[model samples]
Target: MTEQVYACIDGSVSTRTVCDYAAWASQRLSTSLTLLHVLDKESYPVAADYSGNIGLGSQEQLLKQLAALDEERAKLAIQHGLHMLEAARERVKSDGVANAGCMQRHGDLVDCIVEQQGDMRVLVMGKQGAGETHPGRQVGTHLESVIRTLHRPILVSTGTFKAPERVLFAFDGSQTSRKGIERLVSSPLLTGLQIDILLVGADTVEHKEQVKWAANTLTAAGFNVPNTAIRAGEVDEVIQHYCQQEKMDLLVMGAYGHSRIRQFLVGSTTTSMITKSTIPLLILR
Candidate 1:
């Protein structure tokens, strides 16, 4: 089975951007694009909670009415989901993706992705979804869980879509970082693109050696590679500043290296980077 690029949609403002990014990726990788819309059962409106002293007949009639209303709402949600999928499919096709398709699933987004993981080459999704109340503040509720569950490359779309010409890889000398570098070197994703390997807050000889080793590996693989070490303030701030200053097209990094307990107590660099990044982020696990 040929691997396909999957784009998860939620009918948000970011959904269009996700579709655009997926189209760009599908075109670049020479793969089919699948636009997925999962109607989360939990998000559906439930009957109102009634807790008043009322007659038995009245309560039963009210319950029947609420049940009917809930059924109607569910049907409308399905119709809306199908409509979103169709619009996304047309948008991708209009963007010049030849093999574009869409699927409307009835379950949680993470569950749907897990079930379809075997055929997925890469997953593309927005940082925030439709129901996000805060304007520019929190990451999507499902983003972290999806990242934790899937061991594949997830491209988290930020602002808009632009074909990446220069890419930045955040290296911290961890095993996850090494795996990310290995995947980039082995895949055609970054071939012929200018790549910079950045090591932040570590100006020591050991850190420089690690950065040099990574650069050499990529260089041997025929990529235009450069290595830089910054003894800067904070790792996430430094990386974000460098990307902004240099106008980097894409940011690549490993996700969640610390143990679950440590990550919960100290927070995660991966999560911080994703929340702070302005360009698209390719997260490897």
Candidate 2:
């Protein structure tokens, strides 16, 4: 059976690019891609303005008109969202992916993305959407929340579709890192790609040992992942530096490893990577 990939879109300009990249990945891996659009119910306001010149009797009619307008506006949003996703699915179908689909729902976007992410090998999305995405200066917090909450690998499409000729895997000797290595080794999505298995903070004894084991496992599985290490200040910085130096097409790493939910939320390395990487980073949880 083919693996499943779920992607979330806000119908932005990057929506097509994100879907194309997802299609590329699905084709590469022979996975089914599900395109999802989530309309946050929170985007709609519940309260109404009652004060008007025609005071008592017309108030009921005015409220009804207001409700109708809101309903129409909401329906338009849903239709627009579906249009973009359907177009993406059509494109994927044209490219010979038989199992591509488009789904739209009304709820919390982050929560919906996480729920759809269940049982999916990868979750593909844009870096950020044009909305009330808080902390929206450089990198939006909504993307970060999705990355941190969903325990699936996330592929954030920053720009155009580029087949990942070279992939960089951050080897940190964590359980998450091991899972990433296993996915890289076993998944058809990554086959025939030149990989750079980088173990940052390999200055520690445990880190070196884990890297050695990981490298051997990868090699034995028929993947030629060249191993390298660089002592670093912050882990994310090290990853960025190495990825930049190698001109890597994609960076794959674990989202978090054995951390409490609170710590995961507060001190998330995953967020750092999503916010900082020059190229696209595929984060596995």
TM-score of each model, paired residue for residue: 0.88, 0.85
lDDT of 2: 0.72
Off by over 4 Å in 1: 45-56, 256-271
The true-versus-predicted C-alpha distance at residue 202 of model 1, in Å, is 2.3
Best by lDDT: 1
Per TM-score, the best of the predicted structures is 1
lDDT of all the models against the reference?
Answer: 0.80, 0.72
lDDT of 2 by residue, 1-285 (tens): 445888777766567667777888887777688888787777743334444534567577777787678878887877777787778788667766767877888778788877765558788888767563532224656777786678777888875667788888777776666877888787777788777777755377787788888888888888877656646566667777888888899987665666222243336555666667656768676
For model 1, how does the per-residue alpha-carbon lDDT over 148-252 read when each residue is reduced to its tens digit?
888778999988778899898888776657777889988777789999888775488888787888899899999998546545566678888989888899988
Name the lDDT of candidate 1. Answer: 0.80
Q: Cα RMSD (Å) between model 1 and the true structure?
A: 3.5
Candidate 2: Cα lDDT at 109: 78
